[model samples]
Target chain A: MRHILSVTVENEPGVLSRVAGLFSGRGFNIESLNVGPTLDTGVSVMTITTEGDEQIIEQIVKQLRKLITVIKVVDLTDLKSVLREMVLLKVNANDANRAEILRTVDIFRCKVVDVSIDELTIEATGNYEKISAIVGLLTRFGIKEISRSGMVAMKRSIQN
Target chain B: MELTGAQILLECLKREGVEVLFGFPGGAVIDIYNELPNTSLKHVLVRHEQAAIHAADGFARASGKVGCCLVTSGPGATNTVTGIATAYMDSIPVVILTGQVPTPLIGNDAFQEVDIVGITRPCTKHNYLVKDVRELAHVIRQAFYLARSGRPGPVLVDLPKDVMQVKTKFVWPDDVKMRSYNPNCKPHSGQIKKVAQLIRDAERPIIYAGGGVITSKAHESLTWLAKNLHIPVTATLMGLGCFPGDDKLWLGMLGMHGTYAANMAINNADLVLAVGARFDDRVTGKVSTFAPMAKLVHIDIDPTSIQKNVSVHVPLVSDCRLALEALKEELAPSLAEYDFEAGHMPWVTKVGVWGKEHPLNYQASETTIKPQSVVEKIHEITKGEAVICTEVGQHQMWTAQFYRFNEPNCFLSSGGLGTMGYGFPAAIGAQFARPDKMVIDIAGDGSIQMNIQEMATSVCNNLGVKIVILNNGYLGMVRQWQELFYKKNYCSTCMDAQPDFVKLAEAYGAAGFRITDPGDLDRVLRQALDTPGTVIVDVRVEREENVYPMVPAGASLTDMLLV
Candidate 1:
């Protein structure tokens, strides 16, 4: 099972390595992770997606709590949440296939952030499914380069 | 008051009540060493950086205080990694101070520079690299706090040369609080009540204690609970001294080289109160079959340790002492009504029979001294009062088996990490920790040489630490495995060419004694023990002797190859 661990840690230069070391040290590989600053002055939140059983997940949460800089850890997978990812791709393009590429980007609600004589850099933002779907469809277009911001997550809010 | 970064570091250590520091001098640490004479701290200069860390670890385990050490950068810093990992694995509180090259030269691969913080990140409980002298005091304070606080372990503070040489206003941070690092102390009352209820209802209850009991000072409570409830008690190797070894309810040390009684009791136990101990593979012996009929109630300070290896039914994440006290309170009323003693009598009696029938033993010979006999003699001569340390090998197992520990912090071994060459230096540290007590390192031929250079440190300090080498001329533990599983393909286990330990000790200006005959064992051991200086009594034991009552790695606890 895949678990999305939303971890809040002290915002320090080495905090990322400290948090990431826990996973690697325990022989657990993080499938996808993204970190960003939070509302608090000296804190940052990290969203890590990893595969493990119930025991391993429990162990991971407990181990995370042991870290000195880690403030909190919550399994976002157990809660109602929204996950998003952004990926940019520089794909081969030409006059013959330019319209097709634009249409494909248009259908997926993506944007062409950059363009050149031989390539188009497409910007994409969506959940895992959407990101993978777009990447799968663009494979035929001969991707020149690719960059992805591994999944970021947030708990859903109920309006008052 | 304004002080150099080095002075500030020493100030923090002094405020933390540190009296002794086991360390070695090097170029990177020259600044710190320069400032040492201005302070009251006593430094025990060790030959190797590794021995310094191990000595500090031994001191901490013996004194129940944080052990501190200082070493230089690069190779000096790298030397302590094994010792750091040893302490990390066993959860011993040690504060390691490593000198680093100047901040500017750290990443430049300057002379004698290495990224120690990055290297030790995974092994340490927490670590810091002081970039500024202003933060030096705070980092030192916090490092000590982390090293000694809940679930104690090694914490490293890397001191850059420039940082140590700089000056800063010494502001001792009284409040060493890290918002993210507070360990849960009070276990849930509901969980304690549940554990209490389970204990009251259990017919065959057993208390499996570990080093946590000693770490949390819960031995008294553990003893009270086990005695009042008529539950049999077993300890992990690290937990040897937590419970009185001679107590009738004591089933002896449990796990791989554990006694027949301890293993069988765990197998049949209906309820296992696992306190302060992790169910390591050595202890669990085929996890699927471990405690097959028992409902495990694990109480540990580190919550992760509770359910990491085995499935825990009632997990109380709290200090062992607090949880044990709470459980006693919760079970107070029920204790009067529950016929616990009568209910547990049958099980305890059965365990006693197992102990009696298949007790830990060896074939005695008048020609060659048996290692087990050597341990028994040490226990007999010392009256089980001395602080016992052992290097990792069959001798370690034999010492754990024969020398029954009746007090906490008396038995020191690299239990979790099983690091060889740990005993001798640890004995040096233990002697420093408790100068009044007789500290002895029961060693094997292969392991005694690892940190054999430390004889200089012990001799220089005039620490009367006795190193009793059980010489069989082989890496006994690995050799035992070869004899058992590998068709006797001895491989590199044979330690044929060995130094004359006694002569070597004499060369270091320490007493040396060699006992080759069984008839001369006691006389030689006594002479060596009575020596006024550091002594090495190398006892030539029966060759090819194996530590038995063995449960092959993957075998169930009950599946023991007993002789």
Candidate 2:
């Protein structure tokens, strides 16, 4: 099972290592992690995507709460939330498949951020499935370089 | 008042009621040493940084206060890692202060530089690297608070040389607010009621207590709950002194090296109420088959300690004293009418029968002194009053078996980490903590030599700690394992070429006594105990004698290899 944990912690030095150390020390799997400051300068939030069963996740949450710097841990696995991941991929392109590449990018609603004579850099943002699809189709043109921002998630408000 | 970081550290320590600290001087800590004259704090200059941390640990365990230690960087800080991990494993409250390189030189691999905070992150409950002088006072206060709160563990504060040299206005934070570190100390009323109901319904109930009872000082409540409700009690290696050992309700120690009665009782128990004790692997031989018939209710201060090793039906996260007190109160009214004692008579009788059938025992050897008898003689001499510390190996297990502690904070052994070379220096700390009481370190020949140099520290301070070495000329515990399972290969378990401990003791200006005959055991132990300064009594015992009633690693508690 996959769990997206939203962890709020004190914004201070060594907080990242503490969180990372807990996972590595305890042998818990951490698929992806995103950390940034929050509205309060003294606090930060970390979105961690991890894989574990019900028991391991419970242990992970309890262990994270044990950290003195960690403020709160919310498991957004079951909660309705918005999750996003971005990827910057430069693909090999030439006159022969350039039209074909533009058609695929148009269908996926992605943009060509950079284009050279023999290469085209595509920028795309989506959930796991959508991003995987666009990246998979573009890989046919030979991926020259790639960068990814790991998953960032936020809970949705009850606007309805 | 304007104060240097070094001055503020000492000031906060005194305000926190610290009377003594163990340390060694070094280049990184020169600034603090220079400011030491300004404060009236008592410091014990130790030979090695390891002894400083272990001695501090001994002080904390004996006095139930947070132990403090200071050391220099690099090798000095590294030396304290094993000691810190030992304390961390047993959940002892120890605040360790280490001096680091200057701020600018932290990661540059400067002279005597190391990332101690990074190295100790996994072992420490919490740690701080003071980068600014203004944060020094508050960080010191927080280190003490974190070390002593919740589950209680070792906390390190790394002080850079620049920070210690800088000056700032010191304001003692009266209220230390840590939003992420608040521990839940109250159990839900409904859970207490449920626990009470279980106790009432259980016919063959047992209380499995551990080090938490000692840490939380919940012995009184634990004893009352056991006696008033007619339940048998068993303690872990760390929980030996938490309850009266002679009490009929006591089922002796539990787990791998635990007594036969305790293992059997837990094996057949109907409901096991574990208070302030984690289900350590040693206590539970095979986790899947542990307490085969019991419904477990675990109450511990740390939430993560619950269900970490064993599953429990009822879990309460609160201080051991608070939870036990609540349970006692919850059952108070019902106890006034119902005969709880009468209901558990049969179960207690059954446990008593098991104890008689397969007791913790050994055959009397007239010529060669038995290690178990040596502990028994010590128990007789002390009358269950001396603070007993033991080094790891056979002597440790023997002490745990024979030295029945009647009070809390008396049995200080490295239970969780099982670190060797722990007991002697710890005994030094214990002696300093309780100057009036007789402190004994029941050590092995191999183990005593590990920190035997601390004899100098003991002699210099005139600490009357008796180090009783049960000499068998080999690492008896590992050798026993080789004889039983490894085809008697023995490997490197031999230590026959060690120094003559009596001569070694006299070499350090301490009294020494050696007993080769079994007849002289009592007289020599008594003589050594009577000596004014530190006395090392080395008694030769049977080399091949092994501890029994062990539930071989994966075996269930009921399937013990009893003699």
The lDDT leader among the candidates is 1
- Candidate 1 Cα errors over 4 Å, as ranges: none
Write candidate 2's Cα lDDT for A18-102 as tens digits: 9999999999999999999999999999999999987899899999999999999999988888999999999999999999999
For every model shown, what is its TM-score relative to the native structure? Answer: 0.98, 0.99
Record all residue pairs in model 2 with backbone atoms less than 3 Å apart, i.e. clashing. Answer: none
Docking quality (DockQ) of candidate 2: 0.85
Off by over 4 Å in 2: none
Complex DockQ per candidate: 0.90, 0.85
- Interface Cα RMSD for all candidates? 0.7, 0.7
lDDT of each: 0.92, 0.91
Question: How would you encode candidate 1's per-residue C-alpha lDDT over B1-563 as one tens digit per residue?
Answer: 68888888888889999999999889999989998998999999999999999999999999999999999999999999999999999999999999999998878989999889999999999999889899988888889889988999999999999998888789988798888888888899988889988987888889999899999999999999888889999999989989898899998888888999999999998999999999999999999999999999999999889779998899898999999999888877877788778888898899999999999889999899999999999999999999999999999999999998999999999988889999999999999999999999999999999999999999999999999999999999999999999999999999977888877998999988999999999988988899888999989999899998899998899999987
Model 2, span B1-563: residue lDDT tens: 78888988999999998888899989999999998878888888888888999999999999999999999999999999999999999999999999999999989999999999999999999999999999888898899999998899999999999899988998999888988889898888898999999999999999999999999999999999988998999999988887899999898899888888999899899999999899988889889999889989999999999889888999988899999999999998988887987888899999999899988899998889999999999999999899999999999998998888999999999999998999998998888899989999999988887887898889999889999999999988899889888999999999967898888889999889999899988888898899999899988898888887777777788777775
Error of 1 at A159 (Å): 9.2
